[model samples]
Target: MKFDKPAGSNPIDRMRIVGQPRDRVDGPLKTTGQATYAYEHTEIANPAYGAVVGAAIAKGRIRAMDGAAAKAAPGVLAVVTALDVGALEKGDYNTAKLFGGDRVDHYHQAIAVVVAETFEQAQAAAALVKVDYAPEEGRFDLAKALETAKPAKDPNAAPADEVNGVGDFDRAFAAAPVTLDAQYTTPDQSHAMMEPFASIAAWEGDQLTLWTSTQMVDWWRSDLAKTLGVDKDKVRVISPYIGGGFGGKLFLRVDAVLAALAAKAAGRPVKVTLPRPLIANNTTHRPATRQRIRIGCERDGTITAIAHESGSGDQKDGGPEAAVSQTRLLYAGANRLTALRLAVLDLPEGNSMRAPGEAPGMMALEIAMDEMAEKLGMDPIAFRVKNDTQVDPEKPERRFSQRQLVRCLTEGAERFGWSQRNAMPGQVRDGRWLVGMGVAAAFRNHISLKSGARVILGRDGQVTVETDMTDIGTGSYTIIAQTAAEMMGVDLDAVTVRLGDSRFPVSAGSGGQFGAANSTSGVYAACVKLREAVAQRLGFNSAEAAFEGGQVSAGNRTVSLTKAAAAGELVGEDGIEYGDLDETYQLSTFGAHFVEVGVDRYTGVTRVRRMLAMCAAGRILNPKSARSQVIGAMTMGVGGALMEELAVDTRYGFFVNHDLAGYEVPVHADIPHQEVVFLDEADDKSNPMKAKGVGELGLCGVGAAVANAIYNATGVRVRDYPITLEKHLEQLPAVA
Candidate 1:
């Protein structure tokens, strides 16, 4: 079904089950240890273990590699090196070549693979595969390379200068009486998901089957086929369960590709898992960014001019961090200019993590808003509400599908006790701690993708839904079951959901927060077709048929859903294809984050006292799962604000803190009370389900809330991210 226009009174609006707070159907299996992850598939007989050997050098060509020692090792099945595999093509989504390459783009690039009967033997043999490289100097520092930064180049376009902007920012800023310009820095960060990159591969004749832990199943399958120079149909990927992704498993990685190659070479199934230290430098990470924001406003808290320019480093032909994209449409700024510049750096590949552009963009933009609010002597919530725009700030012809930013802010403030916060800093004291409150607006663009699904209605009155959507520790299975149950007018127990199989209809996958909205919309479309089929079989007008109480009714006649399918089982397959609705309306999710922090007077340590988030995405399918996502994001925000930074070794071009022990993330002790509120909303312009994404929306701008709170507590501002206590310890007010 093509979502060309706003839906009018759809079956989902019935709200029989979609909006209820249902627990995850797979929760019991997971808690009972019945569900298995990618690495736990030990049923395969005599599975060989493959250990990867990573390059020690960052940028250089391999001078020589000796694999004879590894081949002679005990229990070693096979040893494969770049020379043996020859030059292979990189996948479209991969920034750096995984294997079979002479030159290394970054530190820890896979150099060789060793397959053996045991994991210990494979790991021991991998160490024997020695490689010599010709080292070369490469750019590693973004701050030092800023002098040579240039406008980002488009891969699809010819050589041309580009700029992302709308109005004359310089003229408006020059005329404004109240103007503020500041620079903020956010360090590179790792996804640090609970699960490691792992895969098990086996080949039967010409067909290859892989059980991998990945967020994008179809993308990985297609990319693996391309990387191995095989037909896409010859590869089948299955990922029934994933511990966590956080955008780290969104593409093909070395573990999956190397496992496939080693299995084929060893003539047996091979399982490969990257070590914890290797995973950090081997996989993609969020690139560090330096952003400068200039805001011009009036005494009434109205913004006139806003300009955001960001600079980041990446390998040649790689994309920038895109930290300036959110400023283009966030607020009502008549004169706005946003630009991005890229510098060449020979570091690990930089890509998506969590909310990507919006997460980091809001880290700086929202803080700028707070600083501006202070300069204007107005409340932050009131400042944001005063500049709210119903339509696109840049293109006024288009209006938001459903904008409730004001409601989120106002309601969040009320719930968070904003009125109790003192306007002056360092006034409120509790024993040995200084207490303060801060708030920031949240924003993330809503994206829709083509998602397909298959629905089967059995004569036994059971419905099965199949799609390639991955769970990724998000309640995809539960919400999908809810959608099918709601559409078929059946209880949740009557619907079965099958996900993460490449043989099924290709789905949007679980990245960019589009999985819940687009994938469920696909299921809704398939159920629509199944409803028509059932009505036709029962001799009822398809358009007039009403599905309720497990029965199909038309006028005065009604029939049980099972009786309608008594002849045989019926199958319906369809996908949700989007038409010009996205262009006609600006689709986005809005939220507000309010945080209270207490800073220790003597130690300069900060701890979260309370947190509240008000989200206004479209129709929330399940409140319980949505709340889980919001709180998890709030915890991550605490980590990003107070900790979480990849210490970069500029000389070697690698992350010095390559393991969890060195990386500090927030624990339960650091977080206190957290509450989530979802405003009632339904946006027809987004999809048939009238739902937007909340996974990423829960993360955007949360760090800035913590940062602003810290400033309010101590009256000291730190522009650098990871706002560690060391950054402001010397500036804190002295107390006995």
Candidate 2:
């Protein structure tokens, strides 16, 4: 089905089963430990465990390796170094050097893989297989690197940076009576998912099968073939379940590649797991950004000029933080300029993590909006509603598919009792703490991906839906099953869901918050075809057939789906293809983030008191899971505002705080309370399901809200992330 217009009433809209708050079908299996992870798959019998050894220096050359002692270690089957693995190449999306490199490009680069009979043996052997390295100095500061930064030349366009502009930004800023100019810094962040990157690769007569934890199955399968110099068809990659990705698993990691090589040498299935510390240092991370935002507004809070220029680093082929992209369309401004510059740094490979550009961009821009609102003597939410834009500011001809940003803010404010907020900083005292409220307009671009799913009707009258779509703890399984059952006119219990196998049809996979809608639309399309096939096989007119209660009826004749399926299992396969609708309409998700924070009077410690988000992402598929995504993202936002920073050891060129103990996310104690409200709405331009992604939407502007609340509590504005106590101690009120 080609989604060419905004969605109307569909089967999913019935809300009979699809939108119901249902538990994950795989939840019980996981909770009971029946669900097997890649590393936990000992069912294969005598599976060997492998461990990786990383280089000590960031930029250096591996001089020599002596595996003599490691080879003598008990149960040490084989020790493979970079030299032992030949003809290995980097994956398409990878930048930092992975195995088979005499010269390391970054710190903690993987130089060797050790395979042994036991996990302990591999770890002990990895430490014993010592190697000599030559160290080299490298630049690690993004702020300093920006000086020599240049516009990234686009190969697809003319040999110039892809730059866009409108009217005179400088003149507009200069003429404005009220203006705010400042710089903001967002530090690098690690995904820090619960599960580490792991893989188990086994070979049988040149046919290789890999069980791994990855986001993109097809990409991993294809890349492994390319890296290993094998035929793509010869390798099968299966990732039936992933603990969590958040963008870290989107690319092929060293675990899969190392496991494949180690299995080839050991002549058995090999399992390789990157140590938690090694995973952080060796893997990709969200690049730190240095952004400068300049806003020129009238005395009445009307925006006249706005510019967001951000600088971030990656290898030569990578692009800068498109952090400025949303800035161009967010609000109405006559003179707007958004520029991105790329710098070179020796940090770990920088890539997407959750909301990516929008997450960090809003962390800074929304706080700027809060400050601007205060400067104009306006309520923050009211000030935002005043500057709302129905069409893209850069391209006024195109209109929004459905813009409820102002509505979201107004309704959210009314429901959250935002009027209770004190306008004066540090004035509202809650016991021994200073209480303040902050608001930020949440915005994230709704993206659509081509997705495919297959539905199969079993002879037992049960419907099973299969797709390569990964769950990733986002309720993909239950929702996809619900979509199939709703279309098939069967009870929800009659539907089964199978997912995350490469042998299944291709799907959008899970990233950018597009998984729930895009992948389920694929399931919807496939079920439509199954309905047609079931009618044809039963000798009933397809147009008049009513599929209800597991029976197909037409012209006073009814047949059980089981009887129809007995004719060799009816199968249906199709994909949801998109059209030119997105171009014609500006489709976006909107929300309002309201946060209450308390500041320590003496120590300057800021803690979240409470938070609420009113969301308007069209047609929530499942309210229960949708709420989970929002609250989870909200908690993640709390970390971004208070604790989550990859402490970069510039002296060594790596993320020094590489483990969970060092790199903190939100714990239960850190999150006070979070509430989410989904407005009754849907966008037809988004998809046939009319659901935009809420996974990232909940995250879009949360950090900014926390930061804004912190400023309101203390009357001190900190531009850097994690707004730590050290940053505000000097500015705090002196104790008597």
Best by lDDT: 1
TM-score of each: 0.98, 0.97
lDDT of 1: 0.90
Q: What is the Å distance of residue 472 in model 1 from its true position?
A: 0.6
- For model 2, what is the error of residue 369's alpha carbon versus the real structure, in angstroms, after optimal superposition? 0.5
How many residue pairs clash in model 1? 0
Over 4 Å off, model 2? 153-161, 734-736
Question: Which residue runs does candidate 1 get wrong by more than 4 Å?
Answer: 153-161
Q: In candidate 1, which residue pairs get closer than 3 Å at backbone N, Cα or C atoms, i.e. clash? A: none
Per-residue lDDT for 430-472 in model 1, tens only? 9999888989999988999999999999989999999999999
lDDT at residue 475 of model 2 (Cα atoms):
84
Which tens-of-lDDT digit does each residue in 230-266 have in candidate 2?
Answer: 9988998888778888999888898999999899889
TM-score, prediction 2: 0.97
Candidate 1: RMSD over Cα atoms?
A: 1.7
